[model samples]
Each structure stands twice: as C-alpha cells, then as structure tokens.
Target: MTQSGFDTDRPVRLGVQLAPQHHDSYQVIRDAVSRLEDMGVDILFNWDHFFPLSGDPDGTHFEGWSMLAAWAEQTERVEFAALVNCNSYRNADLQADMARTIDHISKKGGETGRFIFGTGSGWFERDYTEYGYEFGTAGQRLDALAEALPRIESRWAQLNPEPTRDIPILIGGAGEQKTLRLVARHADIWHSFVSPDELPHKLEVLSRWADKEQRDTSTLVLSNELGRRDEAEARKLHDAGVRLFTHGVSGPDIDFDSVQRWLDWRDGING
Candidate 1:
C-alpha cells in the first residue's frame, strides 16, 4: 500500500457517472456506456434516485440497479455500480443478493465480475417522499445504514453461489462523525465530494478513525469528483492521496470533452 492508503502499484483510474436522468431512451444511455468503455474508462457509475437530480424534478429518469444489470450485459470491461445506493430503499439482505447477482452477470471469458457495491444512507427526501418511504432524520438514516452493513456482509456469506469476487464496497459521503466512521469500518473505497482544499483535513480524520478501528486503511482507496478541475488541480488531489476520480455527466446530450481531458491526464500520470 502507498502512503496515501491506495496500492502504490495500481495506476490512477477514471470513472464517469452517467446520471440516469434527462435521457429520452435507454438506447442512448446504452450507447454512452459503450462509448465510455471503448474510451478506456476504468469504472462507470449511475446515481440512485427515483427522480432527476438536475433540471425538472419530474424529468425522464431510469432506476439505477436496473440500469446496472443492463450494463452488466452491455459492457465487457468497465466496472460499474450506483454511485451510492440508498440503504433505506430496500432490505439489506435483498441488496446483498442483488449485488451478488449483478456481480455474476458481469462475468465474461473466465474473468471475475466487474461490479462495485457503492452505497450510503438515503439523503434525497424527494425519493423517499415520492416512493412512500419515511424521510427520517439524517442521523436516524445513518444509524440504519450502520446496522445494515454487517447484515449485508453476513448475507453475502450465506448466498448459495457467492459473489464472483469479493465485490468492492464503496461508501459515499463525507460526514465526519457517522459516515467516515462507517467508511473506516466497512468500505474498500470512500467517495467524498469534499473540495481539494478540505481533503487533507478529512483524510487526517479518516486516518484517525482507521487507527481507532485498528484497520490498515493504507489499502483503502480515496475517491473524489473531477468536476471542472484542471490537470494542475487534479495533480494536487493526487498528491493529497486521491487516486480514483469520477466526473458526473448529465444527459439529453452527453458530453465527453472534459472526460477526455481527465482520461488523458490519468494516462500521463500512469505512464
């Protein structure tokens, strides 16, 4: 493991979150996934929500897990998952089984599956309200997530045909108290939206939590968003210990201009 907690030998990876909103047809989204994989993106992600996150609230949208299942059959190389599934949407055991099933679906040519289980406590009140789930307090939701993670792991163990591989668990959010502690305890990757300036402090806190939990967090991968950051900014983030960078692209018409720049940057770094 590197000093930053990620395996030093592993090259920097690029991920794109194709927000499953504002698209008129699944074919268009499916084409986009193929384009991304062809472009050599290491990971592909979609958000978990019932409605659009941007533009009109009731715009055209597709559910994340279903889309992921399609992606499993659609692409051969890209690792994919919900950017973060809402823990409150389904039972923990069910979620584990679904993840395992998708993991198997993604396998090809004697290769292990390429599925990552990225999840967190549900936060979008609109999803809960419209979907008929109680929009409980944030703390309450986090507590539920804390309780469910272990059960998810246990269920994975009990499944008849286990996951093709130890499906990586990526916990998203930057809540210093509950979220980070949970990340330390259960996550293989910790995704945060914190800005580059704030990352050092947050990582310090994560390290402290790992020490308290007695886990060797040096193997944990740090993830962050690409947004509008340029190469210099990305380098700073890399220097600060982040190796996995994801950029969100929304649709109607999807753009790959920025994604290409980031991919080029990643290639330069890896080379």
Candidate 2:
C-alpha cells in the first residue's frame, strides 16, 4: 500500500462525486454527505449540470450551487465542492459570490470552512442549448474560461470578510494546449480523466509551464479519476504520483461498496 512519489507521511485524501442527477437528489445528497463524512471521507463533490450525464437523459438532476449551500450547512468534517463547476452556466462575479456565501455557511461554527471552488469550461452542449446559454465552440469556451478565472479570483477578495480561507481552486481537464496551461496558472488542484499512463506526460507538461511561470509545481496537487475497481491499479496510480482519487456512480442505488473500497485504500495508504 505504499504510494510512490507521495509523502506517505501526509494523510491521503479521498473524494467522491455524488451524482446529483439521480433519485431524490436533495435527500440523497444530504444522506450521502452525512454518511460519507462519518465514514472518514476527506472531500465530497457534486457535478454542475442541468441534465443527467448518465441514466435517463432527462433524469432528476438538481442545481449544483444550491445543493452545495445545503451541504455546507449539513456537513462538519468533510470538505465539499463541485467536482468541476461549469463556468459557462453562470457569470464569473456571480460564481464567486455563490462560493463566498457557501464558505460563510460552512464556517458558521467555530471551525473553518471547507469548500473547494472546482470549475472548468462548459462542455455539455445539451446544457447550454436547453438553458439558453450560447454553446460556443471548444476553443471559444476555453477562451471564456481563461478570462473568467481572474475575475472569479478577484471578486472573492472584494467580497466582505473575504472567504472562510483561501478557497482552493480545482480545475478539471487534461487538454494539453488550454486546460494544462490554465491549471498551471490558477489551480491548486488539477484533475485529469485519463489513465495513469497518460498522466506522466501531462504532469511533465504542466511542470514545464510552471517552471516558465516561476511557480512551484509541487504545490499543485495532481488528481485523477479511477476508471476501474482494482485496488492494485489504484495503488499503481498512487505510486505514479496521483494523490487524490475520484470515481463516479449513478444514483438510486449508489455502489457504496465501491466507495468503501476507496475509503479503505485511502486509510491504508495514510496508515
């Protein structure tokens, strides 16, 4: 269970993307948040989209930011965020305002808040078309995202009391030209959907960009979504320098066993 390139001394962090598109989303998310936090998960995330990515195309999906506010109120120990919020869905300043509000909610008690502002360029064409947003080309969307990042960060500062803390930005995507560059400039955490074999090259590219920018690449956390349920494979990923792991499952019957296995792996790695 030894993780290569990772500091075994540092506590391993496990995260889950609670699909908000299935069953009674409001209640399911509430219950899952409580259960996962109690089960010792480090982070909980929900996807930001209007329609279900899986299951019925027009399933019972819920809005991301509102659900997050509820999670901030309900959970105490686990950090919460959207796996990657769609920047095209909301205005940049407004997105920052929503995050700041959630940060305040999570920190209502004596303890500090835990909300990572994970976001990216919008991709689901259905979401944009149905919601009246202009479904621009991929390049155009990336351009918008690049412009929005700074405004989102700046607005967080202008908000009263600032944020509960420095809200960590987690950008999702592995596109070499746009996504990796954006990650180097803005993200505290970079999430890629590819397998481990593809990761080393991307990491190297990011490192090169970081070097050019005079930024400390080590501070940017490398994260990836596990595609299969093999602990050995997950371990291999850990050995290759991916510290944060995420997996997706549809709702109604969430594969809790899958979640437990990941949690167990995280615990064993840290121990």
Candidate 3:
C-alpha cells in the first residue's frame, strides 16, 4: 500500500457525479445510475444541496440524501454517496445514523456494503437562506464541522445494528489550516478541487498536519475533480498521488462521453 491510502498495485478507479439538478424527473437520474454502474464506474456521487448550483437558480432539483437512499436500493455493485455532504444542514448524530442506514441499505447479494460518507463544511449560501439554516461565516462553519466529526463517529459506534461495514469518511476541502487538519484527523479520503499544479503544495501542507496529528496520511486516498481535463492532464494528477478521479455531469441531459473517456483512460493505466 502506498502512503496515499490507495494501494499502488490496485487498478485506478473512476467516479461520476450525477448532479441531481435540471432534471425533469427522477427516472432520468435513476437510469443514469444504472447505466454508470453497468459501465463499471467505481463510485457514484450526488451533491448535498437544495437548489441548482448552475444554470437557472430555481431549476428542477432533487434533495440529495433522499435520492441517495433511493440509489442505495436501486444499484447493486457501485459505491455511492454525496460528493460532499453539507455538514451544517443536519445534526451530526443524525448524519451518522443516516449514513449507517444507507450503508446497510446498499448491501446486496452477500456484498459487504457500499457507502462513502463524503462531507464538508456547508457552502452555497442559497441552500442555507432558503432552507432556514443559519448562513454563518466560513470559519464558523469549519469550526462546527471540526467539532461535529468526532460526535458523528461516536454516534456511529453507538448505533444499534452497526454499519454493515466501516463506512469510509471522505472530507472535501482545500483549506490549509482547519480543513486539512480535520482531514488528517478523521478522513479516510481527502478530496480537493485544486488543479494538478496546485496539488503538491496542498499535499505538503496536509503532510505537515498529518505529522502533527501523528496520523499516517500516506494511507489517505487522494481525490481530484475530473471535469474537462483530458487524459494527459489526468496523468499528471495521477503521478501526483491522486487515485480517484470524479467528473460532475449535470442533468436534463446527462452526458457520458467524458465519463467514458476517463474510464478508458483508467483502464489503460490499470492494464
């Protein structure tokens, strides 16, 4: 196993984020889920938000956790979760319980389980304003997340049936001081939005925090956005220690062309 938490001998993995917005119906999202799974994508993700992040502000959108519950029962082989769950929307204990429930729900035909608890401090102020959540400052939200994570873990330990498996906690953020510190302390996977050129520096900062926390960050999986970046660009990120590449596709017309390209790229590398 490498220091990046990803096994160097294992195959590279591809993930697709089916943004649950601009879709006229749930059936569209459901079909995309099935197709992505059948295509052998490693993980599926949806964002935790109340409205659309792009295009029209009030466009057709679905709630994240509920859709995830439906996805749990709908898919058989693929792991799924919010690309980054909003930590401020729900109680920390409730979030833990919800993730545990989804973990069990996703198990099928003797399969262990498939749930990654990807979360971050809440952003998208519109989600807060319209939903009645307090839109606190960024630092305040990060502090809340720092305090809540341990409680979430504690609640998971106390849950009745327990999770089918140890749910992997994925924290998404690139904030050097607090976010990376929390990642060192709790996350099994750390996701960032930075480009290939910016990753090494961030990793260095993360390593410093890991040393301070006495945590082996080398075992932490590194993730980056797979957005319009071509295969060549992706290889640079891979060389920088990123193993999981995720592409976010918006709805109404969920295109798989880019996803297919990345999957092909992943296969070429793995082979």
Best by lDDT: 1
Clash pairs, candidate 3, are: 3-218, 4-218, 5-219
Instruction: Give the candidate order by descending lDDT.
Output: 1, 3, 2
After TM-score superposition, the amount by which residue 238's alpha carbon in candidate 3 deviates from its true location, in angstroms, is: 0.3
lDDT of 1 at 60: 95
TM-score of 2: 0.94
Summarize candidate 1's per-residue lDDT along 1-271 as a digit string, tens digits: 1246554446799999999999999988999999999999999999899999889988999999999999998889899989999999999999999999999999997569999999999889989988999988999999999999999999999998998998899999999999999999999999987887898789889889988999888778899888877788878878777889998898898988878888998999999
Residue 159 Cα positional deviation in candidate 2, in Å, after optimal superposition:
1.3
Candidate 2 residue lDDT tens string, 91-171: 999999999889889985666688899999989999999989999799999999999999999999899878978899999
Let me know the TM-score candidate 1 reaches against the reference structure: 0.97
Instruction: Write candidate 3's Cα lDDT for 96-175 as tens digits.
Output: 99999999998998657799999999899999998899988999999999999999999989999898887899999999
Residue 12, model 2: Cα distance from true site in angstroms:
1.8
Candidate 3 local distance difference test against the native: 0.89
Worst 10 residues of 2 by lDDT: 1-10
The Cα error of candidate 1 at residue 115, in Å, is: 0.4
**Given candidate 3, what's the lDDT at residue 1?**
14
